[model samples]
Target: MKWFYDALNILGGISFVSVAVIAYFGKLYFERYKRKQDEKIKSLQSRLDLTNAEMKSKLENINHVSKAQFDKEFSIYHEIWSCIFEVADSVSKLRPVLDHFDPNESREERRERRLQAFYDRYNPLVVAIESNRPFYFEQVYKLVCEYRDLCRKEAFEYQHYEDYPNFKDYWESHEENMKLIKEVMQKCSEAIRDRIYSLTIIK
Candidate 1:
């Protein structure tokens, strides 16, 4: 009876030891699996962060290029307007001189000096118009051409023979031409201002 009791106690102790060993190995395997999963999650998060950064950089670069292009086009538009304004100023100054004759000089001498001064002021305008032709829109270019033609015609009228007649009629026609030029200048200026406004809104 004593031997049987000892044998039963020994069997119970061995079973308990076997269960503890199995539990310990199972816990180690589960911990390893959990660590592997954590590593995978961290790698995925790193890749996601990299992708986000790359997309942000690309968007910034695109915006920079778009802004530069807008600035360049706007500058050209402004330059065209500047040329128009300069020509308009010169024409305004010459208007009185062209319409009224100088009493100090002979008629032939006055005509020659007036024509020379007109050409000096007007030729640079023509050159500027031609040089900037490719940069400007069709509407702007056409209006500038019309203005130039009006100025040229007025100058030609001023270059009259010494005994030219019909002073009142000539004055009326010139005045009308001047009014038309003013209207055209206003329209061109408005067009440029509107374009600038549109660009500012976009920005």
Candidate 2:
């Protein structure tokens, strides 16, 4: 009976020791797992922050480039409009026959004066267009060329005013040419307006 009691006591002590050992090891394992999970969370957070930063940088770069391009285009368009205005103004002053010619001024002298005045404005406009050719749309360039040609034709006709049968015939043809010039000027204005509108909306 005494030996059985002793054996039972020893077994109870061993069972208690085993439970304490198991609990300690389990606690250690749980702490290590928690620490590992925390490290993983921190790493994921760091990676996410880096990705966000990269995306923001790329977006900023794109916006900068877009703004620069818009500014350049706007400047070119403005220059073109200025040139058009000057040339158009000069064209308006052109005359096949002067309304009040100086009695001493010969026909050839008047013709030279008219041509010189037109070329002074027209030449600069041509230079501006040619220098910025790469910036203009094909349609715009063609319109400018057409405008130039029409203006030149009108200018050259100054020399031929005498060839016409009468003043009425010459005046009628001059009116027709003026109408065509006005139409071209209107088209150019509309095209430029549309281009500017598009740019404004995009910006």
Candidate 3:
């Protein structure tokens, strides 16, 4: 009877030690997991803060652009349109990034994606203008009109012009937006590079 009791006591002690070991390891694992989650949260928050600040600066610059051509709304729109297309072309390689957005399975989805994708690509170009071009407001407005027309295709099914039986005409008309915007952006980019060069003081 005494031997049996001693054996049970040893078993209980062993069980208790095993349980304590598991609980200690579990606490360590939970703490490690919690620390990792905290680090990721802080990193994501930092990125969000940077993105917001950059966007705010861009919005302020856009406000100035609005003021510069208050009398030329159409032209301003066109330049903006050009900027949009230009940025889209630059971001073409990043088209798959839209995968990060909601899946586009409907007309509405496609339109929203098309609209957002273009702006997401181009918003930065709008603020980088270094010099003014001739009749840019009208030119820019025309470009915007082209963009709107393109958007209309994705956003809604339109009656085709009886004279043109295919989508070629519709696509061609708006395709120039990208090309035109590319030219403008290149000029703007050159101007920006020049400005930066001038600002760089040799040590």
Candidate 4:
């Protein structure tokens, strides 16, 4: 009986020690897991912060480039438009008297009037833009639109009379004007493209 009681006490102590060791190891594992979790969270936060900064920088660059390009293109568009309108105004004046000459109108006189009208109108806008006057482009753009409108009306009136023998010379001038306006439009488009390219967006 005495031996059995000693053995029981020894076994109970061993069991208690085993349980304490297990609990200690469990606590250590839990602490390690928490630390790893914290590290991962910090890493993710840092990456997100970096990404945010990069995004902001890119957006700012885009805005800056866009503004610059818009200003440049606007100047060109405005100038070209004004030129077209001014030239159109001078050309349109002859529309009212166009029918007065009838089909027998001399083509040379018609061509001279048409060519001279365009020549008289175009120099002012070109000179302004060439001199780099501010806002000159805007004025030109408005004028060009006005000219286009007037030309359209003029074309309607000339459509029937243009093929007549005496009116053939006038057609040359009319066609030349169309060609010039189209060329100017092309110039404006090219300027816009060049301006955008020049901006060179930072990001």
Better of 1 and 3 by TM-score: 1
Give the clash count for each candidate.
0, 0, 5, 25
Best by lDDT: 2
lDDT of 2 by residue, 49-112 (tens): 9999999876554422355666776787688778777777776676734577788999789778
Report the Cα RMSD per candidate. Answer: 15.9, 14.9, 19.1, 11.4
Q: Point out where model 4 deviates above 4 Å.
A: 1-80, 88-101, 133-203
**What are the per-residue Cα lDDT tens digits for candidate 4 across 1-203?**
88866775787865776788899999999999999999999999999999999999765644334555567655665665576567656655554434455467687687566656765766665564555545323444444444455455445445446455675556665666566655655565565454444454433
Q: Per-residue alpha-carbon lDDT of model 1 for 1-203, expressed as tens digits?
A: 88866876787865776797899999999999999999999999999999999998765544222566567657766766666676666555444634566578786786677677667767877786778677555666777778778777777666653234776776677688778878887887776665554443234
Give residue 137's lDDT in candidate 4 (0 to 100): 38
lDDT of each: 0.70, 0.75, 0.50, 0.60
lDDT of 3 at 38: 100
Would you list the rank order by lDDT, best first? 2, 1, 4, 3
Sum up the clashes in candidate 4. 25
Ten contiguous residues minimizing lDDT sum, candidate 1: 194-203
TM agreement with the true structure for every prediction:
0.54, 0.60, 0.31, 0.33
Ranking by TM-score: 2, 1, 4, 3
Residues forming the 10-long window of minimal summed lDDT in candidate 2: 58-67
Highest TM-score scorer: 2
Predicted candidate 3 versus true structure: per-residue lDDT over 1-203, tens digit per residue: 88866876787865776798899999999999999999999999999999999999765544233333444544443455466556545444222223454453764565455656655654444342323434343334334444444433322332223344576765554355445545554554454333323332222
